[model samples]
Target chain A: MSAVAAALPLADDALVLSHRLAEWLGHAPELEEELALANISLDLLGQARACYALLGDEDALAYRREEREFRNLQLVEQPNGDFAHTITRQLFFSVWQELLFGRVTGTGPPAAVAAKAVKETAYHRDHAEQWTLRLGDGTEESHRRTQRAVDALWRYTGELFQPLEGLDIAMEPLRRDWRARIGDILARATLTMPEGPDADAWSAGAGRQGVHTESFGRMLAEMQHLHRSHPGAVW
Target chain B: MISLAELGVLRDVRLLDGGRTAEVELTPTYTGCPALEAMAEDIRRALHTADPRLARVSVRTVLSPPWSTDDITEEGRRKLAAAGIAPPRRPGPARGPVPVALAIRCPRCGSTDTELISRFSSTACKALRRCRTCREPFDHVKEV
Candidate 1:
């Protein structure tokens, strides 16, 4: 794939996930959590903006793209089901992003962006892991809910191991490292690992090819609504 | 003149054609910061006022060596603290997989008994912290 093609999917992943995290503003469990989530969202949005700027106008690329044109991973497009679900999603994605960016730093097309982003992704992954441990080991109710989230999101994790065309990093080691790290976290959290599909099993995801979950359409519509309504409007 | 240099955004400035034209390079503290455009406009205005015969004033943004809190000058730190916004702690080791929380001294009381209330604040570059000694909530410049 071309450099633009490679960047578009990664950019879309950040943009879509950022919007989902932004939805937690005013709805998070507490003020601190709200701030934290919003900050994470903003960080992701920043990454998206940087990536999109490499192609064309960041706003137009983000706000004007149709659902069919978006190339985000299905994991990001998944709805933020609850606090546990959100944390789970973040933990999974951040781990992959931190590892991916780490591998691509100084070598890939987006190396400059990755160099900065890996640092941010490290913090993001740490935040999610901390929360995962807290919720998974805290109480009976919390553990149960967190376990359910883990199980529900397990299928989407496979896509992270899939290869992107232009990024030259090896996927096998990344997948191995991701599993080992996630397993260690799960063990520490006292959370039961979900019986994920076999490594060789056919994984279900195509967002890199512009295919997305049903919920993505609704989310994209809402995200683009304001921009579409007021063309060339500025605050 | 609005001091973009003191704001830690201006990376470099040059005068060409015997000071007739001005060229400035800027780096934003955060990628999505809304102030970059305003900062560029201010630079142009300031350059024009400095030399009415200036042939041209050009502003460029560079991101190669990303901006960090360490870029804030000592004077800038004083200005920020005076304005009730805490200056960032000297950056620690580079970020790694395990995120370590650094001990930030309280800007108000100069006490080391500050705790992070949140990892993020209203702005992208600040974190919410509170000083236990003074029992006051404040914002700390986040180490990016």
Candidate 2:
């Protein structure tokens, strides 16, 4: 796999998730939370831009890409359900991201990117972990909602460990560490670990193959609207 | 506009071609910092204002050796505190004449009894905190 091929998966993941979080700007639970979500969104968007810069023509790659062309994990493409659901999704993805960035080897562009990203991902993971503790151990309503979010999003977690084509990463060890860390967090939060197969004949997968879930199309439509409407528009 | 140099993102400046052109290197405090573009533009405008004869001014973003809150200058920390914002505690040893503070002190009351309200705040570079003694909330430039 070429450099572009390796970088695309990471870039697309950041871009899609950034857009999802950006959707929460005016809709978050409170003002501080809104700012937090937006800042995280900006951070992801910046990471995506940095990766896309290595690929050539960041705008064309991002705004012109079709649903079937994006290499992001399906977990990121799922619609944000609620504050509880959003936090759970963040918890799942940020943990995976921190591990992936830390383990990616070599001094290539990807490694350089990962080196910088590992620190940011640590903070993102902490934000999610703190919220997980709050929602899982809070009142009856929060606990129920967070547990529901966890169960709903469990199957989507499997695709994260699937190795990208050019990136030299060992999938099994990454998966093991992910499971151990996630299990510890859930246990402390007083939430039960979901028992479904992370990857199997039943789990959702194939996002790496350019396939995506239903809600992704709507997201792409919104993301591409401004660029498509004016081919050469710039400010 | 005011704190760019104090923030320490400005890494270097060079004048070339008999001073007709200027090149500026900047290291971002965070990979996703939105202020980079504005800072670049500000530098260009400021350069032209200072030297109308300068034909070109280029600002480049450098990502390697990623920035830390420790890079914030001593003057920057003082300005932040004066503005009711807490400066970041250095994650490493003091390397300069000024000593680093070990506590995340309340900029309002100079009390060390502040609790983090959120790990993030109005910007990506800051964390929100509330002082237990003064009962006032403020932004703290979080250590990276």
Candidate 3:
């Protein structure tokens, strides 16, 4: 596979997650929350845009491609279940992003860019952890719902750790180092790190290999609607 | 006939073709007031009468420097007072090179009897505050 194909899935994952986050805009129960969530979503979108821009032109890499041709995981594309679900859902992703961004800060980008993003993602992880604790330990109803969210999302968590083509080659040792750090954080949060049924001792999966979920077609549809509808149109 | 500073612009502000309206993107004094839309509309109407090309004004939400209480401009402070928020007392600047905690004053009943209700109140940017003596609820822009 080409190096671009190998690098595609992680950027794709970031893009899809950015979309789910964008859905929360203007709809948060409180106005402060609306603004805050918007900020977080915009940041993620910015990161995803950067990742895709590296692969190709920002607009084309994001919008010009067909659906099945893209390769984001299903976990990010999953619906936002509820408030507790959203927080719990982020627990699964933020833990991963925190490690990913932190390690990148140590190595990638120019010193200035990497330094700024590391601080920013740290705050994102902080917010997620705060809400996770709140919903996890609040009232009985809150606790139960939050747990259920984790349980439902757990099955899909397996794919996050699945190795992409050349990730081991391209990502340096950050992935290995990240697994250890993530384990400690999750354990501290009193959340068990469950694995897929085929966990351990297995070769990684193929998101970067251009494999994707059925729903990605629809998501790509909505995301690229304007671009596809008005071919060669400038905004 | 406005200075670039009055336009709240800094250096070579591009006037794009699809300019939506003539509006100042004043940073909010606090977050999550239900009145901001009304306030933006009022600014829009004011601008519209002055220049028909200024069809509508909108608030541009910016979070850099994180919208601190310190950002409330002198003119903005006056507007807030006219709008009925008793401004917090600005402490003397780092006297002897040490920062002192500033105090918030109650706009209603001009008393120093004020306390924070919740740090995360009506909005993330504002804290819910109550005047102890008068028991009036007021929003405090956070010291970001």
Candidate 4:
């Protein structure tokens, strides 16, 4: 795939996830959690903007794209289930992103962006890790809920390790590092790893090829509603 | 009108063609910052006000050598502190394999006994921190 093609998937991943996090604005558990989630969402949105700007008008690309045209991973598009579910999703995605961006930092067109973004991803990963550990080891109910989230989201983790077309970074090392890091965090959090078939046959994914989960369309419609309704409306 | 330089986004300014035109370079603190366009427009307006004979004004956003908290000037830091926002600590060496805990002083009380409540705050570049001595919650600029 071309550079733009490769970048699109990465961009879409951030865009979709950013929206999902933004959904938590007023609904987070506490005031601090509310701001934290918004900040993370903004960071992801920034990354998406930087990548989209590489192609053309960032606003047009974000608002005008069809559902099938988006190349985000299915993991990011999955509905935010609960606090534990969101944290699980954040942990999985941020760990992969930290590792992926770490490799891409000094490489090519994305090097500068990756260099700046990796630091943010590191903080994101740390935030998720801290929460995972706290909730997992906190109470019996908290531990059970956190574990349930871990198992439910495990299936989606494999798609993150899959190789993108135009990116030259080695996937094997990233996968290895991701597994090692996540395994350690899970162990510390007193959470068990989900056991099942690998990402290829068992897990449901295919977003990189423009295929998405059923919920993605609904989320996209909501996200694009205002932009589509007003056409050229500006604040 | 707040100048881009005071906002800590302006990087460089140059007068070209024997002062007939002006060029300004700016870097956004965060990639998604909405103020970028407004800042550029502000620069253009300021230049026009300074010299009516100026034929052209160019504003560019530079991304390489990315913007960091370190770029915030001393004056800007004072302004931020006065506004009840803690300025970022001086950026140190590149992060190592192991995470290091850096002390964040309370902007209100100047106490080193501050605890990080969250790595993120209301904005992309700040963290939520609390001072143990003053018992006050404040915003600390994240060292980026």
* Top of the candidates by DockQ: 4
lDDT of 2 at B33: 89
- Prediction 2: B-chain TM-score: 0.89
lDDT of 2 by residue, A70-167 (tens): 99998999899999999999999999999998887777777777877788888899999999998899999999999999999998888998888888
Leading candidate by lDDT: 2
Return the TM-scores of chain A for each candidate in numbered order: 0.94, 0.96, 0.78, 0.95
Kindly indicate the candidate among 3 and 4 with the higher DockQ: 4
Error of 3 at B77 (Å): 18
Task: Report the C-alpha lDDT of model 4 over B1-144, residue by residue, as the tens digit.
Answer: 324566567889899999998899988777666678888898899889989999999998776677777777788888888888888887668899997777878888989999988887877778888999999999987877
lDDT of 4 by residue, A1-235 (tens): 5555567888899999999999998899999899889988988998898888777888788999999899898889989999999999999999999989877744455666677788788889989999999999899998999999888877777778778877777888888898889889999999987777436473345788777778999999999999999887897
Model 1 misplacement above 4 A: A1-4, A107-109, A198-205, B1-3, B16-21, B91-102
Candidate 4 docks with a DockQ of 0.66
lDDT of each: 0.83, 0.88, 0.58, 0.84
Comparing 2 and 4 on DockQ, the stronger one = 4
iRMS, model 4 (angstroms) = 1.4
Please provide TM-scores, in order, for all candidate models, with all chains considered together: 0.89, 0.93, 0.56, 0.91
Model 4 ranges with Cα > 4 A deviation: A105-108, A198-205, B1-8, B92-100
Query: Judged by DockQ cut-offs, is candidate 1 incorrect, acceptable, medium or high?
Result: medium
Better of 1 and 2 by lDDT: 2
Q: Scored by Cα lDDT, where does model 1 land?
A: 0.83
Worst 10 residues of 1 chain A by lDDT: A196-205
Clashing pairs in 1: none
| TM-score of each model's chain B | 0.82, 0.89, 0.54, 0.80
lDDT of 1 by residue, A52-165 (tens): 888899889999989989988889988999899999999989999999988874544477777777767877898899999999999999998899998888888877877886
